[model samples]
Target: MAALNLTPSDTSTFMLMGIPGLEAAHIWISIPFSMFYMISLLGNFMVLFVVGKEQTLHQPMYLLICMLALTDIGTSTSIVPKALCIFWLNLKGITVCACLTQMFLLHTVTAMHSAILVTMAFDRYIAICNPLRYATVLTNVRIAKLGLVGLIRAILFVLPLPLLLTRLPFCANRIILHNPFCDHMAVLKLSCGDTTFDGIYGLVVSFIIIGSDLMLIALSYGLIIRAVLRISSKTAHQKPLNTCTAHICVILISYTPFLFTALTYRFGQGIAPHVHIILADLNFLVPPMLNPIIYGVKTKELRDKVGKYTSRR
Candidate 1:
């Protein structure tokens, strides 16, 4: 392995190896990857369409669903297309600028996705624990404001990542990224310069943003459960709990794989690179692909609206 001793420049490009040990199986692996991406696109678009076209679906919860759908689309779109190109077309060259841009979009949208889930948990909390104040608390204007704040927060935290990477010197010989997409850590690992600050900054950002969001979500659900348990009738318990079912499913799908991938990357020294890469890919693919399905199946109003629209079409 010859080291070219290169720095980040306008002309520097990185080669993406689709999967470290599965180059021979790249085309076969792409079959399911493409399917997941397509399902994510179609399902999330359906959610957006149903939410937008129906006046009855224009509540705070459904509006949040719209935001989730948009983020889901953004998340999948940011990584999957490039991945498919790497897998199928064997076109792996990515310029530094393009790689940084993709990294930014991927991280930003992912952060926003986490924020939206926290907001949804808050919605559930208000609707259950403080039913009387739900409407006033989560008005359309306020939701819009929340979305804006989430976007700004995501940008603030993730904007420095690519910028920080620009300062690190990348080795020309080490430009081939083993993963499908340009991840912050993967790119950082390629740097020959000191990465202590970059690594610490990334870990801090993840803990601050994702860690706090998870804690808030847990608190919201805890309160919701407490409120539900105090109900005297078993039948009444079903309704409020039912409303949270899809959200719980979405959260599980989104976070479980994410935590696994992150942990594997940091601590699983014995784990194979392909295993880590596959889990990381699934973390982005599974949640978006399943979110709309979960909501559609669990929420009666959304299901009815979707059914009606499809029947009419």
Candidate 2:
């Protein structure tokens, strides 16, 4: 156990526990982790590039997708690079400032990802519930404003986290993190001083930011379902419902791992440490890798554009 030192030290750094109890397998493990990183980068960048170049994709839904692609890139980029450095170069030490930056970026981007999903649900709601006014409701300027709001919301809510952490003194005894990347709760747990406020704030932020977004998304879908139910024509109902499949799939892939890991952290008493670490890592990795694939396969416009771009190259 480490003791708390409130004063700043000349040499202070946290050692990352890259797959604890599996140090020997770090080199081999890097292979798949690196593959996921590469694929996430390539896939998300392709979405951004293709959406930008293709004029036909300049619609509200795809525009929201562009926002999703950007958020995925931000979220994955925050974690994977440092993880690869740890695996390849055996560099497990991260400075205090760098660790705080990582935590901020990762959490903020995650909140933004959730926020974007809410907006996408709203987009779908309009398209299905009120198709005739979808254009008027979600205009280019309005879409941009919505994206800004999501970004601002994430930044505002997550801003206090680091400041709060900075006030606490870290234990000099042992700063080894069990996870590959820096997470809010993981870092707070290492502090030697009082962390009750930090923990409470963390829970409050998660609930207020992500919890509210989840409710709004559910409400949007509920309204959408009710509207669809009213449609007597089976073909008409199916058409609008099909438009939401991609977004729904993206939501599931993004949230399921996150919620599972969170629950395990809170309630899992007998779980192995490595399992917790792996889930935390995957919570960041899986969504970015799958978002593009899901959208490309389920969305006709994105699929056609991707095919067209790849064929030309």
Candidate 3:
């Protein structure tokens, strides 16, 4: 095999394969992707608008929703534009520095999204289990602090990832990324130097960030279930449980594909390249496209406010 580059540098440009082995269908693929990206943008923007303008929504739960919306926007915006460019415009080449930048933004926003979900779980836990102290426990100050924690955690952990990858040497015949977007693993796989450390570091970070978030979210729901069970009237239990439905849907949408993609990357050696790429895209794209719809429909107050907001505009 011919070497692609002598060393990883700012001058190095990598080709982005919109969807490997499916080049003939790229035009058709772009249609759905463009639709999703547009919808994700509009939907998330609506959530932000409704949340920001509606004073009644100035609570912890809605605030967390706003955070989630922002995370979705950030994650999708970072990838979808470039992916679309690759698919529609056939502008596939991206500089090493640019690729790393996209990777950093995508991964950091993803980590932040996970952290936000954990915080939302905590919010629901307090709301359902200790209704009396819900407001007191999740005051604006505390919520702001939690947001800060999410940001700091994402910055600290994901910051080193691109930096590490930048240090690696490239020896492939051509720097062709199999995925439309600059995914961390997809990019790392092209390196000539030892990539074992990158893989391990990614796994460690995933376990620490996503695994812990999932565990805590599960724990929160467990406590919530126990509390709900204590209520004698089914009506009373349903009232509290209903409040968590939207969040649960959002969590499932966000985590399931993410976990599937990460697992397939690590363990699914026999899996098709296109399948892995699809799962990876879905992990980022589907959540953004679905989250706002789920929230808009499942949340009565947000739904009503959104209706009123749209009517006026």
RMSD of 3: 3.4
Off by over 4 Å in 1: 1-11
Write the candidate numbers in order of decreasing lDDT: 1, 2, 3
- Structure candidate 1, residue pairs in collision: none
Per-residue lDDT tens digits of candidate 1, residues 1-313? 1112333342578767779889899999999999999999999999999999999888889999999999999999999999998887777778788889999999999999999999999999999999999889999889988998999999999999999999988875545545799989878888889999999999999999999999999999999999999999999999999889999999999998888887787899999888888888888888999999999999999999999988998
Minimum summed lDDT over a 10-residue window in model 2 is located at 1-10
Per-residue lDDT over 1-313 for candidate 3, one digit per residue giving the tens place of the 0 to 100 score: 1212232342467777678888888889888888998999999999998899889999888888899999999988998888887777777778788889999999899999999999989998998888898778999789989999999999999998999998898764435556788877878878889999998998799889988999999999999999999889988888888889999999989888877776787899999898887787777788999999998999999999999978988
Q: Between candidates 1 and 3, which one is better according to lDDT?
A: 1
Better of 2 and 3 by TM-score: 2
Residue-wise lDDT of candidate 2 within 155-182, one digit each (tens)?
9999899989998988764455578888
Decreasing TM-score order of the candidates: 2, 1, 3
Worst 10 residues of 1 by lDDT: 1-10
Query: Model 3: which residue pairs collide?
Result: none
Among these predicted structures, which one has the highest lDDT?
A: 1
